[model samples]
Target chain A: MRVLGVDPGLTRCGVGVVEGVAGRPLRMVGVGVVRTPADADVADRLVLIERGIEQWLDEHRPEYVAVERVFSQHNVRTVMGTAQASAVAMLCAARRGLPVALHTPSEVKAAVTGSGRADKAQVGAMVTRLLRLDAPPRPADAADALALAICHIWRAPATNRLQELAAAHRRTPTPVRIPKGTR
Target chain B: MRVLGVDPGLTRCGVGVVEGVAGRPLRMVGVGVVRTPADADVADRLVLIERGIEQWLDEHRPEYVAVERVFSQHNVRTVMGTAQASAVAMLCAARRGLPVALHTPSEVKAAVTGSGRADKAQVGAMVTRLLRLDAPPRPADAADALALAICHIWRAPATNRLQELAAAHRRTPTPVRIPKGTR
Candidate 1:
């Protein structure tokens, strides 16, 4: 599965495309950051982000898009910006009917480094090694984007199974027992 | 000046359009809510918001789009959704190259009711009074949206002056000072 991972931010949105399924070698197709001027209005900045993400979608045409799930508790100052940027990214993917998945920061870190608390350097190291890259992607955000893509590719199988099981359970209706007295 | 105001929310996004300048009477062109199913995916919800906002823009073609500024300090649980919804609203306006203004909740309340701490009912009542409506718009969100538009219209003059002053200051470069010894 080819997935485009987005590490959403207002100032600098990191994007990376990775292709592979679980239990297979992953290949990095592209990596870059979509930057917006800090001095620009938030609305104008969102328009720029939309254009940037659209360019990436046009070029990569990934089957799925993975975005970092934003939590309001992360950074009090920039949480709003992060959430806004993520919204633009998700909107772009969903507009094209592409499935979008959100991975928590820790989930991406754990998927790549085997530790949810792994630092940036650790994630960078793992992404480089896993993708057989000559060096880790620049600007920690870029590496994190790749990590998100890797996480989605690796976890999709299990997620699908769980979803299937839940669906099956819902499909099976509960049987109602008739009381002898009521009957 | 005509303004389209948006009260962004995931489940129900309220929108209203008001046409008038700061001093004169304002006219309510339209008022409604764009709703998405609670069970819908966030990405799909955003797309629905985008479409809804686009339709409003297409129908009204307001000179300015006014959106409530989302603060992270607000309801922690729903703040993220609010931010995301606001982003989509801004994106729709900015894509059309329309000027977008964000009014704080207090600002909107104060503009209509003369008190920043006014309750929803107060704001709604004032909005109905200001617009000469038969009754307050249905749904608190819808009334709040009209209040936002009213705020933008009332505040635009001062905001423009401030922005003009700031721009003029930027244009006027600071003179370099040379000490006698240096000279």
Candidate 2:
């Protein structure tokens, strides 16, 4: 499946689109970053990011959107802007009725580099090799976004099976048993 | 001026539309909250919020939007969600070319009540009295939104003057000096 991965940030939002599924060679469809000035009004900056993401979505039309999830509630700084950008990305996907998946930083790292503790450079190098590109994508954020998409594509099959199993369990009601004197 | 105040929240975003100018009778054009389930998918929740805010804007046709500025990054738990909702509100305003204003919690409280540290109930009571409402608006968030609108109306004149001064300075050319013999 074609997937658009978002490494969301207020100042710089990275977007990468990849096409492939499990056990297939992934191809890079698109990659870019949206940058906004710190001096601009917050509303104006947000508008810029929103429009940029919308343009990317319209152009790529990914079947699924994989976003880097913000799982930490520990750090107060940078959370707000990051979350805002993440939400904007998600909104774009939702508007198009695309299935959205979220992967943690560690999950993406492990999926791409086979090590949860792999550094950014390692992940970037893995993304480059996996996509068969001569060079890694420009800007670390862009490379990270590509990694997120690759992670989602590789993990989707297992996730689908788990979801299917859960659905089956839900559909079959538990058998009721009669007590000694109960009808 | 007509102003829409947004109390941004992920689960319950409060929106209030008020019409009037400073030193005039402020009337409530509309008031409501957009709510989504806590268990809903993040993308779906954002889409719900985006649509709700858009509906409010379309229905009210407000000339300006006043959003509560997120100041503290102290609380990591809900800050992300709040900031995301705030961004959504700002995007709606920006899309319509409306001038957006941001007010801090303390500023809103100070504008509504005589003190910056006034409690929510105090702010609500003042909002009711200022708007000549029969009772305080339902939900604290809704009341806070009205207070935000009121704050913007009262503070806008000063903000406008600053903006004007800044714009005027930008328009005038800066002095350029010629070298000693070139003059």
Candidate 3:
């Protein structure tokens, strides 16, 4: 399966596309970065992001999309902006009817670097080694996007289990089944 | 001075370019919207935003950029993404040596609607009325961007005062003259 991984941000976003299934060596399809100016207005930046995604989708057409879940601490301003950015990504995925998976930072780090707390540099290094790249992906965002794809592959089985459980729950009979004449 | 206002988001971003000086009515030079699919990857979305901003800047060459200062809430996931989007905008503006300003949501709302608690629709309506638009800007995001520009104009005097105070604080006192043999 072709999987596209994204590191979403307002200013700069990193994207990596990989083609393969879980537990198998994935082939790199493409990698790139998108940047917005500090001076550009928010609306313009968002428009740029949308257009870029459209172009990437048109070019790669990946089957699944994986995005890093937003994580914020005490910075309220930062958190709010991040949320808006995340919404854009989710909206994009939903609009296309593509299944989207959100991975936590720790999960991505653990899957890629065998450590949940791995820093950006460490994650980049591991991604390079895993992908057998001649050089590390420029800009930490791109490498993180690749790691996110790797994380999705590692977590896919669990995701399936969760989905199955949800489905089973839905299939379970309601506690109060009424007769046809019942009010 | 030319000011670009942005209402940043993941799916749609509103951009407005206005020109005016202190005590002068701001004239709308241009306005447009950029949209992205909800299902596109985050990286691609950001790339689209960057390119869109670059295109607008190249075309319009605004001297200043103003964006809404995002405020975070309970949605950690969404906030992170917005922060990234804001960063992209800031970077874009900084690259061109264009001064950037951020206004709070309440400030923008109050400036546009005369009420800080106004909803998007209300704010949008007021923006249309204020700008003398034939219709409300499509997708709502555009209207919000225009409102942000209006806010910046309303608040510019206060910002100028702050700058003056800061400048005064930085002025060094004249060096004391030392008599040749007084000591």
Best by DockQ: 1
Give the runs in model 3 whose Cα sits over 4 Å from its true position.
Answer: A171-176, A179-183, B1-69, B73-105, B108-183
Q: Candidate 1, after superposition: displacement of residue B64 in Å?
A: 0.4
Q: Rank the candidates by TM-score, best first.
A: 1, 2, 3
Highest TM-score scorer:
1
List lDDT for all candidates, in order.
Answer: 0.94, 0.89, 0.75
C-alpha DockQ of every model: 0.77, 0.57, 0.11
lDDT tens digits, residues B70-163, model 3? 6565365555555656655665776576767888888999887888999999997887776677787877778888888778877878886885
> Judged by lDDT against the true structure, how good is candidate 1?
0.94
Q: What CAPRI-style quality would you assign to candidate 2?
A: medium
lDDT score, candidate 3: 0.75
Instruction: Indicate the residue-level lDDT of A63 in model 1.
Output: 95
Q: What DockQ does predicted model 1 obtain? A: 0.77
Q: Candidate 1: which stretches are off by over 4 Å?
A: A162-183, B165-183
Fnat per model, in the order shown: 0.98, 0.78, 0.17
What is candidate 1's lDDT per residue for B1-183, written digit by digit as tens?
899999999999999999999889889999999999987789999999999999999999999999999987768869999999999999999999888889999989888888999999899899999999999998999999999999999999998788689779879989989888985
Better of 2 and 3 by TM-score: 2
Q: Which residue pairs collide, candidate 2?
A: none
TM-score list, all predictions? 0.91, 0.89, 0.56
